[model samples]
Target: MHIYVYFIYLIKNIFILQYILEDKEINVFHKKEGNMEMNKPNILHIFVDQQRFDTIGALNNPIIKTPNINRLVKTGVAFTNAYAPSPVCVAARCSMIHGQYPANTGCFENDLMPLDNRQTLMDVLTKGGYRTHGIGKCHFTPDALALKGFQTREVQEELGVESVENYPYMEYLQEKGYKHLCEPNGVRGEMYYIPQPSQLPPEDHPSQWIGDRTVDFIKENGDNNEPWYLFSSFIHPHPPFAPPNPWHKLYRPSQMPLPNIPDEFESLHTFVNKCQNRYKYRDNGFDKNLIRTMKAYYYACISFVDYQIGRILDELEKTGNKNNTMIIFTADHGEHLGDYRCVGKRSMHDSCARIPLIIKQPGKFDGGVICEEAASLVDLAPTILGAAELKMETHNMDGVDLYSLIKGDITRKYVFGQLNYNGMDFIDADADFENYVTNKECKRAAFSTYMAANSDWKYFYSAPDNREFLFNKKYDPKETRNVVSNPFYKEELKNIKSSLINHLKECGETFGIEGSDWKAHKLPPFTKDPDRGLLIQDGYTPWVDTYIPGYTDL
Candidate 1:
């Protein structure tokens, strides 16, 4: 009877052990499948306004001190050839968020905004259970209209006193007792290349403030179970050419190297010549000292921003979120920095269009890899969504996922950019309107510029005159000469033009020159309103037109 009792006890113990093991297995399955929400990676997107592709030391620039950015490059895949979809600030940023080219989004200029009804990257991420936050210059729309999808903490760089009030960065300046000196040299509209040190302390600079706020956000929410996406945008290394304190003195002007301006720059294109002339008259001259000083301040500003980036990265590491967070660093567009004797963007040159792009995803992708694939800022949205393992309707997006390119699943042959002079006022209306209306080349150069570039060749088409400029990029990387007139490259030019036309069709672009059989047709008419001028007239008045209702006959 005792032996029988021992056998029953042993059988009960086996059943209990089996029950416990099965229960643990069920719990493990729940954690893996049911709690997939907790497995999403955090995204930290760092954007610098008007930063060039060549500014980072890791990308072959030996002079600029971007140690923190170099650290990111060491742990990230740096795209050596990344172009901005639009060279202008608002258009480029709009392309970034919308995952479409400016042509598709109808945001071809600084003043234009993407349609509010259209879904953005932030909208997709927020819907996919990610907290979205924007810290600095979004420039998507005016300050009044908050971006539809994200909680924004803006730090705008407004010029006039009336406009400056209530701006986050301006308010910060007020608190720091430096509100009186907001604009460099007290100039408002165009003060980008002024070579004066900023009067405000380094701590109060916009770059530092942006970085500080980003760190705070990370620390407060890093441990939270929900995934987060933060856009840490900086406005520096862009304007006023003023770096504060030691940074201002960090790079001596005399030691800085000037951009190479070719002897044949005059014969390149009318637009290029116009830019040079505009700067020469506006800034007194593009003298050696002026160019060197601008370069010094620009480099110093980059280094300062790099320092702040280091602090933000340090915070991420301290919070133990480094391995789980994907860090992406890029810029809206690039600065001219005296390239072709120009000081700002709005050109089709590589200096104005190509930007730095770096992505760091620890334990998921190989570190210290350089991706030489041709990519654009428009690819950013799809890439972020892909990295988050989220799915959406990407049929409307013009760009492909960078991950696919990185994984060798896809390839990109050419990158495109658009320069629509929607809001630009290049001439006095009273003095220049007659010439603008009559001179085809002048009008075209002033109105629109379209670009298509691969690794070896680049093609630019000016809409107003239906003129084309082709460059052998491998030989003339600086774009000092227009080679369309050469017989040797005639076939290449024809092919590029055909490719651009096909791209326009793919993006559903109806504006500018409509083409067929490798030939251009009629040019799009210019309307009274510049923003709507590029749109083909179809007897429909734009809502922005300030005309009395039913007064069309007038």
Candidate 2:
């Protein structure tokens, strides 16, 4: 028996060695196929928070000057119709990290982090023999796990008090003798719609700090033989609308255009109207001047982020890793930026759902190719894994490989999105009638929302009121009109609804749909309570009553 067990162990070891050698050979083959200079490609994924698709200059926006991003677009494959699976921060990020939707991951809201044992993109890449590092705002709960599969991690927490010693950004500020400078404008936590110049110097700004740190990392590890995956996430262009120094004055408010509020905005869906009314009553509403000023600040923030990206790219080139690195630029979600009189996310509007996705695979694809393939952020993991010559089980991913879609090997008919208000707030089903309704006439309409969109049409379903909204993208790109009840487009509405139902079934989600027969999706078990650590360890504070437009109280 002992001799037989030894023989079996030897056989297993041989098979493991063969698998490793095969993986290396496959990587070499991918290099040759793509005409790459290295056997393994390094991935530099730069992600910005709350960035809009129209913000990039290459995407035809006349205002913002994103020359660096434009250069990537000029050389990369730009997906014109990319969207977020969930139009919120944590949920969308979870989808990207796990290659799964909110329902599958159980990360349905900003406060809900992924379960500890869940498989992440970093986990896969690290297991595939890549050195993974994460910089800036990872937003992972239990801060220690922020770098789960990352061999090294350096994070700059977004929101924190000076009293907290664990906040890296605050510590950096303290080191610079600029203690308590993050809130220099006297704006407490969750203060929104306040436009001002950053109190810190240009070099001391968080965006600049993130750029400097990332460049340092590249210079240190750029020439290493092992492949690496670095995620440089920036937290700017998300809130406070503050940019330091020259950036704050980069654009003049008077020269900017006003938000495109439709003439029939008041008669639009009740959910939208309610959001607008809430903002108006709560903050006394914003005027034209304030709106333009906010836009200027927002643009300045984007430009600053662009400058940092330029610096990072320059570092990559300096380190001789430019040709072997696959650069991906995208955002977690999009900001409303005064669209429909809204400033934050959490609605079904395109401004909040659509994100910019650009992938530059050296030598594999030509520059300046605009692929109009409908894609989602969830596809990012599989696409990156594919580029690295790694394979992921199809059953484990909700998004398809974007490279296949770009090469015309695979086609997607529609992309989907979801919003679970129940996950956002802790509300009693029987008490919160005003915000959540489950009546037969309007079951699943008030709090939960889902969306389905193809190349030409977009459909939204609100569960609280059983409301359905349909818009034709060819004519109504801004989604100003709801033609769901239009007799001429009855078939289109039905088709979209059917597509969404099929998707829900595939994802094993039964919520939002009005039926009790469907099976509930099996989500990963949370080993720890999501709200246990709060702001000290988690990047966010749950149930905080704040002045932000979209913030809710339990």
Candidate 3:
């Protein structure tokens, strides 16, 4: 067993050796070396909301500074073309946790229950004896379902039941004396604009509270013997378009770079109508200055979130748990930020669906590995399960294990994504539920959309109307030109359209192997043992872990 030399000096206790070798060698001295086999390295998933693909410094965004995330990218694999199968929060998060597509999970929209009471990634890992904890914005189910895998939850608590309903991060901070972040004022209606932290103390901001809580949790639980899976979901870089004073001043509005927006961008798709409707309600319009200020604050929030991320990594290093910990950083979905004059997700455009996905697997995968192959958020669940040596079935799972992709095996030709095209689901829900749906069902139903891509040519298929978009990504990465009706690529369009239909059939109905591409992997039987917390607790966290660093001091 070759053990390349590296060392760790604990503040008060002992000196430990770090090794560079195969899994077998590490397993040999696992016990005596203080790195037990049973202590299988923990997974730390840091998810940010509404962050785009180019937001990270490592991705060549010289204008937007994100050093902490850049460091993660440098030390791991960055899936450059990663996208959410569904851009909305609930659908995306549900797919992420279950490794199933939104259509399959039935949590296809927000504020919905887990499909068929199915076990989640947390449930599976917890059942397999791993410690689990969750902190921050959980928008999927109601507060009732939010605490399923988490022992403690920090949610959106500052707003009223009508405003705050399922917002988890806000609740966590409001409970911890950070109430000013959500104070309603005359500047904007309640819940529309979360005012910049003018009246609040520094420590009262949501970001700062989340960071503080996470640090405290690490200090307390870093010494635990069992392996753990901790997920911290940040609400920032998700708008009211307000950053705390510190973050607001961190980036200059004039200096913030603007994303590419074609003058004729709105003409490309019918989804822009939805953007038009959303703008009428919020005062933050599509004007250049407003967008610039919003972008600056957004970048500042990104920087602020990065600082909090650094804090978690710093705490992990200080606690001597850094070596055996795997850090996975990504976002729920990307925001349009005025791209195509749209503010947020709910479309299949790059600005809305594309997100940053970086995985830093300590000692296993090296830093600075960039994978250009397409990937989905749903891939994260199975990838994590695979990393921990836990058994995970890909049955009914639409996402492939990303471990292989990270290792440089690029075999995929095309990646697929879709939004629901049915208003029936929306018409069936209550006002609260309807709010969570966000008119997605109606919009998608009004426009059944599908996007298919090869390495260069990308196709966007709009059914019923039969509108098509064909763009050469290599030539026009901005995706400006739509050559769908161009007589030159008729055969190519036919092939892509046929492929999309077949893919939809496979994804839609669980057809068998020759016809049913889905693998029938079974979820283990659910038991009603009261001690189920043993498994569920693998993802446990303290209340304060929801705060972000550099966002608080007052």
Candidate 4:
């Protein structure tokens, strides 16, 4: 009996090794073949929301402990400079699905969404004889479960009450008798940064549910003879940095470092940046303690998520499909975490734009390799489709297949982005988009902003402000110095501006560019109302209201 068990274990390890060391080149599978799943590789895409680039312990972060993410970094190829195409929630998520920048997809902000006409990577995978399933927060518009391409999804949107019907996490809580104890995604608004423990236990938290559901999927499909694409999305470390019980106390505020809140950072802010600051409550009474505690809670939330990730990974190994799967991990965008005295996303600075991207495939670099190339979320779809060895002739993807990038077969000189201030990510953003963009008098609060970044420099142009910034990432990895006005770098600024213009023109999103220069206008920026409270207006009811569960005043 001992010999038989040992023999089976040895065979399983050998099987894992053999498949893991398959040919590096991605070969197409015959879609018409009945047993196509037998030859093709499975894909696992793990997504997190609003996680910054420096949170991984393996990635130079000494304060945060993320062993599972570290495991991925140690075993996969990690890219140090992956940026969101648009540094907001819906836009970046849409770009990942549609394989295009915001300009092309017409979903440049939270208010917009991927139109049903667009072909998604999941759609292509399903058509190519692979099962597609998404679990957790997708944040798609019109209908949360609007199956753009996924065969099905178990949604755990941020706010549980508003997206209540058919919401698995909420139903789980309700059935388990924990529904009255907690609100989704933690308490919100002015208390967004306060450190708090989750009302539910660690095993019952939404993050754990997402992980549990994913593991269950893998277990059920392990021997199904069909390759699959599973997108496991998590909503945490976004805001209200709440972690369950012990995890919430895992990190102390003293251990968490303060954000880069430079003395003059407020002066350096753009129109949209300033508005975001006021709305997020970073404008008043923000200090070192708050930032430190916020970081502590944020790290705790991440550690919790990382713990869940380990469960998913273990299941993959037990199912013996670990090596046959290509696991890609990334976030929609990043958080400010008090960087530049800002609290949330909606800026082109590295604090908000940069994301963590790690991809693990078999037969790759020895232990793992750290890639220094500049990558973007827009590249996600193309990479997935390429890995599945499937192609759709009807659509043109804005990003190149990442294998070309990893192999150094092609080099991307620049990754460009467009911006729309989604007005701080409120639920009814669509109803208020026009209101925020331009008032009745026609003065625009948010302008047409564009960004371009390569290996050395990062540039942004805000047409309404007639403001442009150029940061020498080579010298200022902190992105503190805006050298756009430095006469010594005039030519560098001109060249970057030209490249940005050409990109906009090429993509047909050049509303603020004319001839060879950016269009300049002296438009008034968004101003604060002295009497304005948390509510945008009196008697206004948002489709989804954010409040502290036990305490409502905040």
The candidate that wins on lDDT is 4
In order of lDDT, best first, we have 4, 2, 1, 3
Q: Using TM-score as the measure, what is the rank order of every candidate, best first?
A: 4, 2, 1, 3
What is the per-residue lDDT of model 2 for residues 268-369, given as tens digits with 9 covering 90 to 100? 543533442233221246587888998899899999999999999999889877777889999988877666666677777788888999998666544689
Give the Cα-based TM-score of candidate 3 against the true structure: 0.77
Candidate 1 steric clashes: 1
Q: Write the per-residue lDDT of candidate 4 for residues 1-554, one digit (tens) a residue.
A: 99999999999999976674465653323222354434577888999999998899999998788999999999988989888988888889988888888778877678668555768888899999898999998988867778888998898887544434677777667667653454546766656666678777888887889989999999988776678899999998788788888898898898778788666685558766765666666676668887898888899999999998899999989987777788998999988888887878878888888899999977542257898888999888888888777885567988877777988989977887877763333222343454545552122224556898876889998755678899999988998878898998998998888888888787776556667887654554354563233423111111334467888974
TM-score of 4: 0.87
Q: Identify the superior model by TM-score, candidate 2 or candidate 4.
A: 4
Residue by residue across 1-554, what tens digits does model 3's lDDT show?
12322222242223233332444223221322465555367788898888888788878888777878888888888888888877778778878888876656755455475635676788778878877877767665654335665555656422234333355444444566644332421122322323253344346555666787788778877877777788887777666556666667877767766656776775665433243223334323556665677788778778888889999989988987777777889997887776766665666677777889988775565557888888888788878888777755435566777877755664666666666544222122345544543655433434345666655667775442345678767877877778778888888777776676577666653221124222221212222332221211112112224356878654
Give the distance in Å from residue 279's predicted Cα in candidate 2 to where it truly belongs: 6.9
Error of 3 at 493 (Å): 3.0
**What range of 10 consecutive residues in model 4 has the weakest lDDT sum?**
535-544
**What is candidate 1's local distance difference test score?**
0.73
